[model samples]
Target: MNNNPFCLPVFTDKWIKHFNTSGQEKRFDFIENVSFVKKSFLPVYINVGKNLTKGISYKFSNTGKDFKKKVFLLYDVPDYFELDTTHNFSSLKTIDIQQYPGYLVGTSQYPDITAFKKSRFGKSSLAKVNKYKRKLESSFDITYTLYYGDISRETYDLVFDKFKELLEKRFSEIHVHNNNLDPDEWEFYYDVIYDMILQKKASIYVIYDGDKPIAGSINYHFDKVAIGAIMAYDIDYSKFYLGFTIIHKLLEWAIDNGLEIFDFSKGKFGYKTQWSDQEYYFSYHILYDSSSLLANLLSSIMSLYFRLKVNLRERNIGMLKNKLLFFFKKKKKRATKDYKISEFDDTIDSQKFSKVSFDVKTLEYLKRITYDFLYSRSEHIRDIEIFQDLNDKKTFVILGKSAKQKVTFE
Candidate 1:
């Protein structure tokens, strides 16, 4: 909690500067709530991370005695903290409640990553992870690289571009807006990460397919913990479970690097829950002077509002929010024919096959399955061949050393 990357020096001036540029004054500390207390001129100190994705590390002064006059708002606080008790809010009122469920791996608790993972999933799961890694390695000319402390600017630019592309593409396919792609947010990441990398406070872990960075993860390192901040993978290689593969590589790297915790931050994603050894919750804390009736009422009201909001999000209201999001913000996707696996085999065909120039664009729809085929067969990308059937133009054949695969689509 103390080493929260968002609260660290890595983003010290950058985050608040980004905050200011977004028309949020940095001196709004005395304002209780922007949306609620804006007109009331109430004294409040809102301490939170960027967009509340992280809980800002705050030092208590005088055990809550100093800030009794101000209504303090802090959210996305980890459950491991007993701030209300430790702060001794005897003269003040503090309301803390669970917000988002968090998942993380207590890596220091284990001898190595293998032990850490086995503690979460059984021994068989390790085999499954190995199988996936093998599939990915066999599928493409892939290399796992961790760029930390020292990385060429050109390579950083190349990989970061691909990282943004992957995140944008993945989110676009699902019609969800990727906040990481936001111009201001992306700018901060692009600028801050390079400096942080040099300072050994951040890292970019990349899964490269030959010269291409197909999947990438950005992690912030603080003290002994590494926060799994942003991660995205090429959907084309998703059939090989690149998501699982990447996390395994990351965890492996983490263990080797002597990291203690691999915090998956705030999300309650299935993969995080599946791999993590610990389950916790981000809490929302409302601190206000109990002596003041108005501050107490405001704190209670804000607590009720946030508690209800988080509760609703934890329920069907969250699904409805997504639906609403899609309805309002969904982009007009391109009109593409329904993708179907199309393959033609010269061996099985009565008609002759031709090796005429195949449109690379046509393979766009077939990329995933083709990659998957390479994975299962352990075939190198160059070793595989494609053909068109003379009788049926829609049918395509994928010829490998051991066998041939076919796909047909209208």
Candidate 2:
């Protein structure tokens, strides 16, 4: 009976960081346990033992080892947003569809921000500050609906196919080359995701536009709280503002269903900030066996260096781009001179507005930032508060004071 606790597999360094930051720790003795995988390898799975309530155990696997980690770590954070129990949509009179033409504009048009402010529900009454702004448009006849269900074999296959298709199209558009997964591996990945979603009581919402699937989102419900997961929209209907419409519909559903928190997940994007009034701090952890000290130390040192470089580039380069855009706009305005200044200014403003008004470039930039920085960083281990002592063959558990208690172990 080899009594050595197996080192659980981790999918990414990000997951390792998440485990470290989650504030729970345990040591498993490896008496009857043996692991075929090494912690240093990519896609390391660490088995902690059996879960009592859910009858499900825990394992960690890293999907990417070399990719640069996104800065906005949503998966590392605790849920800080409280569910609003008083939200009611039926109380407000529904506006005629013919009155609001800009309702279904693309996400790049800042529809999410606009809708958040304009929405009659989910507004905080504590302060009189207005968050949403009004947009000029006629009414749209479309109404976004929310749909949720378990991932069956058919649905799972559909989602997996859609994800691959979307990933390939996006990669090609960006001119990036990456290896595609074989059918078996792809199915395995989907199975893992599907299992996790079920354990988390997750639901998928697909918003339709006249029977066509325009946008989709995955949401997880824990207790009375719902966390928004991966969301994407069809590129062809980018001008339809499907993302915002879907979000609004989901929020309404949350309120109606008595779900408390609607976590936007992790990121500090302009739109997320505009709608969300709260934020939770998050951190990352790095752990390794004491026997493998040298290897772990080297990996940690390299990871720290890479992270520092990334932070510097994001701050400095991002600032430089903003400054350059500001100067260009200033110069453009300064170069404009005419005898009829008011009339010329009006004409210029009209022309400039018309040229840029329907431009979804800004929306695309927001999506890119959110997807790269916020959404990508959210893939990590969850429900990892316990560990099995491999040395003693007994389950070592860590207890906390409160339901949302924060605990850390080395």
Candidate 3:
């Protein structure tokens, strides 16, 4: 056991049972390490072997309400550490800390893989996926394989090398070359994946075209949750849509293994929403021991700094949005007139379809269908118009600089 008084030892089944006997839905708190800290010793023993003056600082994602309340019970002024960081704060009650937003893709929303593929949206998505599979198969022999529960070291090393090569090549295509990603840079992931593999707590899925790996995903499993950590596909097979194909296979595997949650971990990706049922944020908290005046003062100062940082970010939201737009290579100017989605009907002119604005509901719906289309890329898009056909049916027209496409709502 660790000698640090600030750390809590790993709990056994007895402790878990005691805490979960309330008959409520059980929640598993995700942690990167086993050394734990209670709020009581946070001020003095926080730095552990380092220095007491530095205090303790920890970051947690997907923190349970029970755990948050426990921290609140231990701290004197719990609100002091709470950071106002989330846009969806209204969903959660007034807690001692703010939750930083994060994304999760889980199997809880769907009963089974079959049911998941049976929805209208699911059917449409799968149809496109199948089409891609057929197109890819015409060129090479395709196979999807998963490594979990006793993967040999030889297999682990081989797959890890291939994943690295594929990732580097893919990034190179986008002009995002990372020359520093040598063996040393990858050692951390290699060690973590290897350990998890030995314990049968990780899954690595790879899609191959003949003997060559085309795409791969690394996932860690813990207490019924599978977290997807790394994913990369060969740029050569990108046109075949292998990236999406590999994740679909991983989800199918998760269902087969009875995993409850399939967390994408972190990021703001458009594709994640396709398989996600809900979204929540992640927050970092640092609680100082109240008895120590110096620790309390430092902690209070740090909290104020974080709060001000968030406020400054909010004021300059436009700059951040523009940066995101540029990263996606999208146009920055708006071209259409603003109109509430509900107000769109046959009375609207088709000429106005070149540029159109939507209400929140329509904007969200468009995002789901287009997969963050506007935010990612609006180049060559002359106009986006919505109107009703002669039969009073909703129709969307995408008028490009030299091309046109029409979408009819069912």
Candidate 4:
């Protein structure tokens, strides 16, 4: 009923059937109507006729014997798009159809409540969640002790060294195949993270097992949401599920501090889904020069093959009982020598941990005293010092140098 001439349906099943029904089939051509310009690496345009329901036409070159003598018919349309900014498509050859890439898309608009509810520790429904909450009347011992402090220079160095050691031990166990993340890269990344945390738009939570920090997570806060940016755990404690426990502790801290949402960030993995209730589609777009026709054709073919392979893998993952479809095989390698525990004793200068030289034993005693005092008076230390600017905001707790006095969110 619309009067717009551009609003015509050009490629329809009825028109195709009518074309095939005609006695003359060799070198047949038909015009298809389209409103938008065809986007392709090559320059192309669409022709729309006056008859709104009818088709429009386009031309193609017949260059060599290598080209098909006849047009091949297929059930599915080829996945090819013209090079317009809007990404419109029209006709594609059978060869072009085989070379499309498969991709994933992620967006923030998707609701993840259902996925969250299905997580390993998630309650099935609102009623069940309320029931569970009601049953727990007392607080339990959380695995990690969260602290915010202006760590001394020595302490910073010690922490960074420990992190490097932990990364070396844990990377292989975690099946991290990226050979690019070497010690130097990690050190550089850590330095950047540490600076950001000190600037107060971020906070680093170190999880200690006794006097040793075995796990840690860096969090960035924005309004009511906290994003767990980077996390690492000592490989020696892998059996204890230290990573999960650390995350659990972080979430508990968020809830206690009145934070509403925890963003896990991007990556498609079963563990992420365990704590997340949503998924988003992510896509990739590639632009290539039309002058390199052979290269483009070959690349397109390879892309299509990979797409099919990835699709099959995804389908298999969906059918499996455990969504994390990975296999690990143990291989013996030369174990790195472990440092003696006494080397970390408090008898050494605590300042040596950074570069200054204060008695390590004195440092240890001071920490214990600070911990005891903070533990007892944490409730009184309610107001947290938060810094914010147009670009970023962060929440933090400040612990005094010589006193047990601390500052934190109420």
Candidate 5:
């Protein structure tokens, strides 16, 4: 049995069982126990043992002695791995490490909530937060609660349902609702949440407007670190900034609980930096067994390929693509300016002050310069309507009027 912090047999077994299901609805189909694949010539497994969430340690388990198939690939391993320190492996051939920066909040950064609040939100942020709090309180009675220990069965189900609903709602607004996942995936998550709660290793924080729960977060406690698992809030209360409020409340809870670290878990979103003092990084590695010359050669080739790919990816290739694409877009826009700009209706429709009507072709063109030329005037327009002109001629129209609309693009 592996004695690694993440390799606890009891909890790991439960984790696997919760995620692994041999059914038609295979959400976590790629997850397999490392022990099961140790005998294969080149066993590929993620460095994820069951504990860490953010930096995925992906690697190939080269425990098999078959030298004919020497080169193995482990895609995403952490940078902190020291080969000399890691033991119990006999056939690990060669390793190539690629640095992937991951961020985490350090526990020792702040002594207390006051210091954390000052550093995280800045000086005036507390006043703004209070303003939002007061606004929320004016409408409804507001209360915050963090649940730990063995929670009631009823509360667990309610929290689970509300959290899932809020997540779906939030993602739907961002047009990523499909990624919110299916029922089977939710069931798997339900099992893990239940297990964590039953073990008294989970902390659930809820914000209630009167008796109705509006926002909540589910966090897991492992060792001295508190890992934020999932957080969601009612979209209706988005104007009040409930999400930020809940997370701020969680940090206070973390300080009070004597937790050493509040692991924001992964992703470098701006909100994560609101209270984060430091970040931890991880690496990706591709390893090979060094039994044969051919194996060594193959490993070297893969190492080069992976290194090049990671470098290219990390060099902001997407930004380059956008720039090149924008250059061509400017050329196209300049060319299209020669086309006659027919104004269909320049009259400000009093009934349609919150709407903009334009042809599909005009809308597509507007999107290019909308950020630079029209962003400031966007608030004057509420809804956009694209219509097909029967005359086969393109027309651009600004259907609304605002005091902010000082320039006319057409």
Candidate 6:
């Protein structure tokens, strides 16, 4: 236990119970050492926790050939993690079953965020992110707060609630389901995270517009590594490119606080790839006793299944499935357009659009257009005015200090 170099919080008993547990609680074991009995129903249940499992760093040892399970499979085992299963099994099969790339930023390597950004990203990319940050701050009372090791229960609840709301709204627009918001598991998150935060194992970085959380990220920390766990931004703020800004802020926090690695775990998203300096793969470690025919058969079958799945993902079948869902969901929800936005020149028309008193809550759909206008034009939120068309209920206009946008619906 003292010799274990890996301090991944994912392998902790609490994380395993909350994130990876199904009906197979009895099958999984860990800590001083780790082990998992394969699923009873299927020996080929290879993806036990494909996306969620960040793997462990321990080698299996020979226990005088008294293996209860024919085959042992470990997934998401990062290349950096030390593992030598040769002592345990003669027929060990290591497969590069990484479905998506894993990334990390060596925060300790750079003195500060600016230097880190300068070294990792080109000037244009850095400038673009900076522009978004500037625009966001210009439009609102922006506050960047980091809550680690201490936070009031009330503020924690409020931030998490808003985080879930933003996640739902963002994924809804793109027609996808976020597993984090699943009702069955969300309670675990709400309950577990607070104590974890107090224990210094968890963190929440929030970008606030006054008291409201517009963007946020929850990260897990162990030793020097900080895992970028969950992140969400209000879709209404999408035009400001809050994703880039949130990451930049998070990186800044991580570096300032002495986190060595910012593990952008298990994703090939454009942002992750762009920000990453060190690249590693999550692989499957299959150990089977050569004497056991059942073990060999099962491990081979499981390995083949993972290879096939990875191949399918490579061809972008996942995107195809999402597209299909988007089509079906759009039809099921509503084929009609909620609103349409276009550029227009301010002019006197017979319909006669007039400025109206409104708040952000009045027309949620208009928020994106308004933010986009702020991105392109030099105007603050206070200087902007919303207008309604006298003749058409479906038509409206948003007038900024120097720029205007036309909003219409059918």
In angstroms, the error of model 2 at 327 is 30
- Candidate 6 local accuracy as lDDT? 0.71
Model 4 over residues 1-410: C-alpha lDDT tens digits?
A: 12111122222222222322332222222212222222234322212211112112222332222221222222111122121232222223323223212111121222343333334353454344433222211111223544343555576676667766666556554444322144444544455445444544456677665566767876654445555655767654333455655655565566556665565643455556655544433222222333446535644654576468557656664334221221232322323322111111122222322221112532222322223333333411122111112221111122322232321211
Descending-TM-score candidate ranking = 1, 6, 5, 3, 2, 4
Name the 10 consecutive residues with the lowest summed lDDT in model 3: 46-55
Error of 5 at 207 (Å): 1.8
Write one digit per residue (lDDT tens) for candidate 3, span 220-260: 66566676768888654455677667767877777777877
TM-score of the candidate numbered 5?
0.60
Best by TM-score: 1
Task: Give candidate 3's TM-score.
Answer: 0.53
Against the true structure, candidate 1 reaches a TM-score of 0.86
On lDDT, the stronger of 2 and 4 is: 4
Q: Write the per-residue lDDT of candidate 6 for residues 1-410, one digit (tens) a residue.
A: 22221233333344456555453533322112554534466543333343444445555444444443456666677775555445534554444455557898889999999999899778887898788888889988899998998999999999999998887777776666556666656766776678778888778999999888999888877778787888989877777888898899989988988988888887688999888898887776665555667777777887798889889888988777765765665522312246787887867464587666546455555666677777778688888878888988678887877788888987
**Candidate 1, superposed: residue stretches over 4 Å from native:** 1-3, 21-41, 63-68, 81-90, 334-359
State the C-alpha lDDT per candidate.
0.71, 0.36, 0.49, 0.38, 0.53, 0.71
Per-residue CA lDDT of model 2 for 1-410, tens digit only, reads 11111122322222233333442333223111212212433422232321001111112222222212211101121313221212122221111011100011122223344354454334462122221100101111233544344557675566656656554444344343323333443443444445545554566676543444446676655556566655666544333345555666676666556665576754355546545545553222223332344544544664475466447655665456544554553422211111110101111222222221112542232222222211122311121122223333221222112111111222
Q: For model 2, where is the 10-residue window of minimal lDDT?
A: 94-103
Give the count of colliding residue pairs in each prediction: 9, 43, 10, 29, 11, 0
lDDT of 5 by residue, 341-402 (tens): 33353444534333333225444444323222223233212333333333333433432334
Error of 2 at 84 (Å): 26
Which segments of candidate 4 are over 4 A away from where they belong?
1-151, 174-180, 221-224, 285-410
Query: All candidates' TM-scores?
Result: 0.86, 0.42, 0.53, 0.39, 0.60, 0.82
Residue 198, model 6: Cα distance from true site in angstroms: 2.3
Error of 6 at 358 (Å): 5.8
- lDDT assessment of candidate 1: 0.71
C-alpha lDDT (0 to 100) for residue 238 of candidate 6: 75
RMSD after CA superposition, every candidate: 4.1, 24.5, 17.1, 19.2, 10.8, 4.2
